[model samples]
Target chain A: MLSKKVILYFILITGGIITLAPFVWMLSASFMYDGHANVYPPRFIPDIFTLTQYEVLFQRLDIGKNFINSLFLSITVTAVSLFFNSMAGFAFAKYRFKGKNKLFNLLLSSMIIPAQVTMLPLFLMLKSVGLINTYMAVIIPGMANIFGIFLIRQYVLSIPDSLIESAKIDGASDFRIYRSIILPLAMPILVTLAIFTFMGTWNDFLWPLIALTDNSMYTMPVALANLMGEHSKDPELMMAGSVVTIIPVIIVFLALQKYYIKGIMMGSVKG
Target chain B: MRIRYSAPYLFLTPALTAIFVFFFIPVIAAFVISFTDFDIYAINNFGTARFIGFDNYKALINDQLFWTSLKNTFYFVIAAGPLSIAISLGAAILLSSKLVRLKPLFRLTYFLPVVTTLVAVAIVWRFIYHPRFGILNYFLEFFGINPIDWLGDPNWAMPAIILMAVWKNFGYNMIIFIAGLQNIPEDLYEAATIDGANGWQKFKKITLPMLAPTTLFISIITMIGFFQLFAEPYVMTQGGPLNSTLSIVQYMYQEGFRWWNMGYSAAIAFVLFLIIFTGTLIQFKLQKSPEA
Candidate 1:
């Protein structure tokens, strides 16, 4: 029995190390000076730990601009999406209307249509309206997603209708009921959705790669990729850039992981 | 009464309108544009583009690169999908075991890659797969295996990407599987143990059957997501080493954005949609009939 327990720990620990090694390597290599990461029998730690790689990334590469771009876009998308999805979700949950079921079902089924199908025409449409190469190009499509609305609606459904009815009887307006009752009750799911949205926008590569044509407007991922194109020889610098790109989302995930994990479980409950 | 009647629509108006204009319309427009010879010229003036039905699809059929990308995408989905799901299930089972301690810490460590920026990690793995200085090759040398040019060899490029993808994604499905495992009533396991069933028998008789629905859901979503492989190969090899790792979405991006062959790109997009839709339907059908 003792041997079995030892074997289990051994397996778990081994798996954990394999899973974390790349990240550990990345963090270690980021602090090495130029050409230092390329030596044979790769050094796991810097010979003389330095901040030169990070200094180059921020000062020479001006990745700070891209960092701001990513942060701005992620926060903007998350806040706007939360508002729009919650409003739509509240309507779907509490209200009676013509074709509500039909419309909701249509929206649900449309989720299967991959976003790639719309990218070409969406680009064209945005280009025609002269919205290309702007923040709006990213924010517009992300303003409200079907999944966000569905998640919000599922959580909002559990809020007792009696509260809304009581609020209504007290001559509170419809908007008032939504603002006071639904919003407060749905806070947990909202936080969950917020984390998902924030991470998604921060980590997004494709759309930003397409829409943000200028280098200055590039998000962290796109900037990192662009830097990679020109600086593949500089592993230390690239690793530093990578570290900068990933740290915020990791911190966000670790800080709010309970909500994030709950969100995933809630989303998988077959809606 | 008037205000009450209008309230839902008022609340829904912003979201519904955004979806209608940005999402629904673009989807329809993409379908329409796929039937036309839309290109850079079409971007300048819509009237210059000519309607050419099925030509794009025919072109795709004849296009060697498109076929290569389709094959590569299927290869990725078929290979990586099952491998990731299996690892996820194994990890889920281990974590859920009563003997485990520090379950949350272990889970967070494993799930770290899932939440990181994909482009950044792909770059990190690109270096990690380095032939001479890479930690992977350095570790493998202890087992008497020679260093491998992981991203430089046609035979190994796809496998490298698959390994990285599996590492990055398994934690997601692991979380879902843990939820599924927890949902199984404790009494089911209690009854099996009381019957003098061994561990393997209990798992086969109780766990597998109970986890069917969750497995089905995981498999379908994982397949869909895997079929859309782009960033790893894009950042790692640019679909190189003889294009062994080019994905369908990458191909679409090349034609649509890089080359501005919008019509052909839209056609490829539709094919992807059809494949995913068919895959989902087939899974649903398969899952339904087995129980009956």
Candidate 2:
């Protein structure tokens, strides 16, 4: 029995180490000098840590601009989508409307259509409207997602109808009820959805790479990919760029992990 | 009275409009564009695009690179999908075990890669797979193995990406599996234990059957996600060393965005959609057949 316990812990700990080693190496390599990361025996610890690579990234490469771009886009998209999705979710949950169930079923079924199928024409559609390479190009596509709406709707459905009815009895306006009652009540799911949206928008690559043509418009992932194109030989510098790109999402995930994990579990619950 | 009726429509208008314009329209437009010859000239002048029925799909049938990417993508999905699911289930079992302590810490560590930006992690793995100076090779030397050029070798590249993908993704399904495991009634396990069942026996009998629905869900989602393999091969190999790591999406991206073969790319995207749709249907059918 004791031996079995030991074996279980051993496997778990070893798995943890293997999982963490690359991140540890990436962090360590980012602090090393150029070519230092390429040395024989592949140092997991920098012999002498310096901030030159980060300095190069921020000062020379001006990745901070891309950082700001990612920040603005992620926050804008998250905030807007949260509002839009919650309103839609509230309607789906509480209100009785003509064709509501059919409309929702249509939306739910269409989730099977991959986003890649829409990318080609979406780009052209945006370009035709002179929105290409703009922040709107990223934000517009992300403004409302079916999954976000579904998540919010699921959460909203659990709220008692008495509260909304009482609010209606008190002469609360429809928008007022949503803002005051539903939004506040749905705070937990909203935070969860917010984290998902923020992390998703921040880490997105292909769409941003396609939509944003100019370097200045690049999100962190797209910027990191661009950096890799020109600086594949410079692992240390690329690692620094990566560290910059990944840190925000990590911080966000770690901070609200309880909600994030719960969100995944909530999402995976078979309809 | 008027406002009462309009409120739901008011609430849904913004989201529904955005979805319709951006998502639904584009999907329909992509299908239409797939039937035409839309390229760089078409981008400049919409009239330059010609209606070419089934030409793009036919051309894809003849294209060597398309077949290579399709093969590579299938290879990745087949290998990585099962591997990741197995690891996820294993990890879920271990973490959910009563014997394991500090489960949250272990869970967090494993899940770190899932939350990190894929492009960043892929780049990090690219360096880690460095032939000579990489820690992977350095560690392998202790086992008396020679250094292999992981990303640079056609034979090794897909496997390398598969390893990284499995590492990156397993934690996600592990969380879901944990949730699924939690939903199983503890009395069934107790009944099995009282029946003189061993650990593996209990698992094979009670756990596997109970977890079937969760397994089905995980498999379908994992397969769908895996079918869209891109950023990893894009950043790590550029589908390199003889295009061994090339994926269908990467091919679509190259053809549509890079080469402006928009019609052909749309066809590729549709093919991917059809593949995922069919794959999902098959999983659903397979899952149902046992019960029937």
Off by over 4 Å in 1: B1-3
> lDDT of candidate 2?
0.94
> For candidate 2, lDDT tens digit of each residue in A154-177?
999999999988888889999999
Q: All models, DockQ values?
A: 0.89, 0.91
Q: For model 1, how does the per-residue alpha-carbon lDDT over A83-170 read when each residue is reduced to its tens digit?
A: 9999999999889999999999999999989899999988988898999899999999999999999999998989998898888888
What does candidate 1's lDDT look like per residue over B100-189, in tens digits? 899999999889999999999999999999999999999999999999999999999999999999999999999999999999999988
- Docking class for candidate 1: high
Candidate 2, B1-292: lDDT as tens digits: 3348999999999999999999999999999999999999999899999999999999999999999999999999999999999999999999999988899999999999999999999999999999988888888899999999999889999999999999999999999999999999999999988989998998888889999989998998899899999999999999998999999999999999999999999999999999999999999999998761
Q: Lowest summed-lDDT stretch of 10 residues in model 1 chain B? A: B1-10
The numbered model that scores best in DockQ is 2
Q: What is the C-alpha lDDT of each candidate?
A: 0.93, 0.94
- For candidate 2, what is the total of clashing residue pairs? 0
